[model samples]
Target chain A: MIKVLFFAKLSEQLGTRELLIESNNIKDTEQLFQHLLKYQADWSGVLNSQIWLKAVNQSMTTKNVVLNDGDEVAYFPPVTGG
Target chain B: MISVQKQDFNQQVEYNRLKSKTSIGAIVTFTGLVRDINQDQRVSDLTLEHYPGMTEKCLIDIVRQAKARWNIIESTVIHRIGALTLSEQIVFVGIASQHRGDAFAACEFIMDYLKTQAPFWKKETMESGETKWVDAREADQQALSKWNLENKC
Candidate 1:
C-alpha cells in the first residue's frame, strides 16, 4: 500500500489527513492522484486549484517519480515558515 | 541542532550553545516573532502546522547546504508550532563560524531557504475571530532567487 498524506490548507479542504492506497497499479504521484479522483470527484477542484508540492518518503519529488510499495507520498502548499 | 517544537525557546541559551566552541569567532542569530498586524489586518493569533518527518529532513538539508557553502562551525535552528499569540516567538536561526562574513551569510541563507523550502504552513486568526491561511509571498521567492544568483557569480 502507498501511504498518502496532505497538509495545511489542502488537508482542511479535503477533510482528510492521510490515506492508504493499493499500490497494485498506482505507479507514481500522478497516477495516485488520479486514483484518488476516481473515488471522490470533488477532490479534482481542490487538487487542481493550486500548484501542489509533492514529496516521496520525506524527500521533495516531482509528479512523475515512480512509487514503490510502502512508500509515503505527501502533498501540500508552498511553505511559509521561518 | 534542529528542533521543531511547540515550546518557546530562550535566545540566550541558543546563543550560548552556538558560542561554546572555542574556535568560533562570530555568531549570528535571527528570531522571527508574531506581529499584531499583517497585511493591514489585525492578527490575534496563529497556528503553525508541519509534516512530521519531512519537516526535519528539509531543515537538515538546508543546514547541510549552508555548511557546504560556508565555514560554519556550529548552528541551531528552532521552529515553533501549534497555537501562537501576538509577540510570540516563531522561529530562530543561529550560526557560528570563524569569521563574521561566513556567519552572517550562512545565517541569512538558511533563513531564506527555510521560508521557501520547508514544509510548514501558517494560518492566522484575525482580531475579529475570522481565520485564514496565509498565502506564500512572492517576495520570499525573490529573496531565495538572490542566493541562486550569487551562487552563479
Candidate 2:
C-alpha cells in the first residue's frame, strides 16, 4: 500500500488527511495519477492542476518519477504566504 | 535543523541550546514575529497551517543548501504551527559561522528560501471583519528563480 497525504485546500476538499492505496505498485507518474484518480471523483482535476506540486518523502519530484510501497507521497498547493 | 511545532518558543533557551563549540566565530539569528499590520491592513490574528511531514523535510533541504554554500558552524530553526495572535513570535533561525559574511549570507539565504519554498500556509483575520487564506506571492517565485532550476523544469 502506498501512503498519500494532502494539504491546504486540497485537504479541505478531500476531507481526509491521508489515504492508502493498494495497488500493483506504481512504475510511473502517469500510473500513480491514474491510481489516485480512482479514489475520488475530483482527484484528477486537483492533482493535474499547475498550482499543485507532488513530493515523494518530502522531496519535490518530477511527474515521471516511479513509486514504491509504503512510500508517502504528498499533493499540496504552492507556498504563497510570507 | 527543522522544527514545526504548535507551542511558543523561548528565545534565550533556543539560542543557548544551539551554541555549540565548533568552528564558530559569529552567530546571526532572525526572529519572525506576528506584526499588527500587513501592508496597512489591520490584522487581528494569524493562523499558521503546515503540511505534516512535508514542511520539515522542505526546511531541512533548505538548510542543506545553505551548508553547501557557507561554512556554517551551528544552526537552529523553530517554527510554530496552529493558531497565533498578534505580537507572537512566529519563527526563529540561528546560524553560526567562522565569519560574519557567510553567517549573514546564509541566514538571509535560509529566510528567503524558507519564505518562498516551505509548505506552511497562512490565513489572516483582519480587524475589518474579513478573513482569507493568504495567496502565494509571485515575487517569491521570482526570488527563488535566481537559483539555477529554470531550464531544469
Candidate 3:
C-alpha cells in the first residue's frame, strides 16, 4: 500500500490528513495522483489549482519519480517558515 | 542540533550552549518573532503546522548543507509550533565559527533555506475573527537563489 499524506491548507481543503491506497499498477507520483482523482472526483479542483510540492518518503521529489509499494507520498504548499 | 517543539525556546540557553566551545570566536544568532501586522491585517495569533518526520529531517539537511559550504563549528535550530500569539518567538538559529564572516553567512544561509525548503506553514488569525494561511513570498525564493549564485562563483 502507498501511504498518501497531505499537510497545511491542502489537508484542510481536502478534509483528509492521510489515506492508504493499493500500489498495484501505480508506477509513479503522477499515476498516483491520477488514481486519487479517479477515486475522489471532487478533489480535482483543489489538487490541480496550483503546483504542489511533492515528497516521497520525506524527501522532496518530482511527480515523475518512480514509486514502489510502502512508499510514503506527501503533498503540501510552499513552505513559509522562518 | 535541531528541535521542533510546541514549547518556546530560550535564546540565552542556546547562546550559552554554542559559546561553550572554546575554539569558536564568533557566534551569530537569529530569532524570528510572530508579528502583529501582516499585509495591512492585524494578526492576533498564529497556528504553526508541520509534517512530523519530514520537518526534522529537512532542518537537519539544511544544517548539513551549511556545514558543507562554510567552516561552521556548531549550530542549533529550534522551531516552535502550535498556537502562538503576537510577539512570541517562532524560530531560532544559532551558528558558531572561528570568524564573524562564516558565522554570519551560515546563520543567514540556514534561515533562507529554512524559509523556503522546510515543511512548516503558518496560519494567521486576524483580529477581525478571520483566519488564513500565510502565502509564500516570491522574495524568499529570490533570497535562496542569491545563495545558489554565490556558490557558483
Candidate 4:
C-alpha cells in the first residue's frame, strides 16, 4: 500500500487530499504514476504537463525513484505557493 | 531565521533580535496586512492554511538563499497562519545588512518568492459571507522570475 497526496488545484479537481493505492509488484514511481492514472481523469493533465514537480518522502524526486511498502508519495501542480 | 505560525509577531523585538554585532548597519522591515479589499471586493476576514513542517523549512531555505545572494548580517521572518480579521497583520520580514540596498532588495526578494513559492494558502471571506480562495498573481510570478534569471546568469 502506498499513500498518495495532492494539494491546491489538484486537490479541488480530484476532491480529496489523500488517496491509497494497493500494489504488490509496483516497484518505481513510473509504475505508481501509471497506477494513479487509472483512478482519476484530472491527474492525467497534471502528469502530462511540462515542468510539474514530484516529491517522495518530502524530497524532490524523479519518476524513476523506487517505492516500498507504506511509503508516502505526493504530486502537485508547479508548486506556486509562498 | 523563519517561522510560519498562527501567532502574531512583535516587529520591534524581531528587529532587535536580528541585529548582530558583526558589522550590521541597516535593518529593513516589511509588514503585510490583511486589507479590507481584495480583487475589488469587500472582504471580512481571511483564513490562511499552510503545510506544517514543510512550510517552516521552506521559509528558512528562502532566507538561506537570500544569505547566499547578499552580505546579510542577520534576518528574521514571521508569517501568521489561521484565521485573521480585517486590518490584521499577516507577515513580517526583517533583514540586516551592511548596506541599505542589500537589505531592501533581499527583503523584497524574499517576500516576493515567499508569496509564490511558499505553501501558504489564503481563503478570503466576502461581505456576503462567501469564502473564496485567492489566486496567485502574475506580478508575483514575474517577481520570482527575476531571481530565477539571476541564478542562471
Please give the TM-score of chain B in predicted model 4.
0.93
Off by over 4 Å in 2: A35-38, A42-50, A80-82, B18-23, B38-41, B128-130, B147-153
Candidate 1 residues A1-82, lDDT tens each?
9999999999999999999989999888788888877658689888889988888888876548798999999889988898
In terms of TM-score, which candidate is strongest? Answer: 3
Model 2 lDDT per residue over A1-82, tens place: 7788888767776677788887466766568777877767887676666567777777777667777777778877777433
Encode model 3's per-residue lDDT on B1-153: one tens digit a residue.
Answer: 899999999878899999987999999999999999999999999999999999999898889889998999989999999999989999999999999999999999999999988999999999999999999999989998988833210
C-alpha lDDT of residue B13 in model 3? 88
- The segments of candidate 1 whose C-alpha lies over 4 angstroms from its true place after superposition are B149-153
User: What is the lDDT for B11 in model 3?
Assistant: 79
Residue B44 C-alpha lDDT in model 2: 94
lDDT of 3 at B90: 97
- Tell me the deviation in Å of residue B101 in model 4: 1.6
| lDDT measured at residue B77 in model 3 versus the true structure, 0 to 100 | 97
* lDDT top scorer: 3
Residue A81 Cα positional deviation in candidate 1, in Å, after optimal superposition: 0.6
**Candidate 3 wrongly placed segments (more than 4 Å):** B149-153
Task: Calculate the i-RMS of every candidate, to one decimal place.
Answer: 4.3, 3.3, 4.3, 4.5
Q: How accurate locally is residue A50 in candidate 3, as Cα lDDT from 0 to 100?
A: 90
- Per-residue error for B103 in candidate 3, Å, reads 0.4
Model 4: what is its DockQ?
0.35
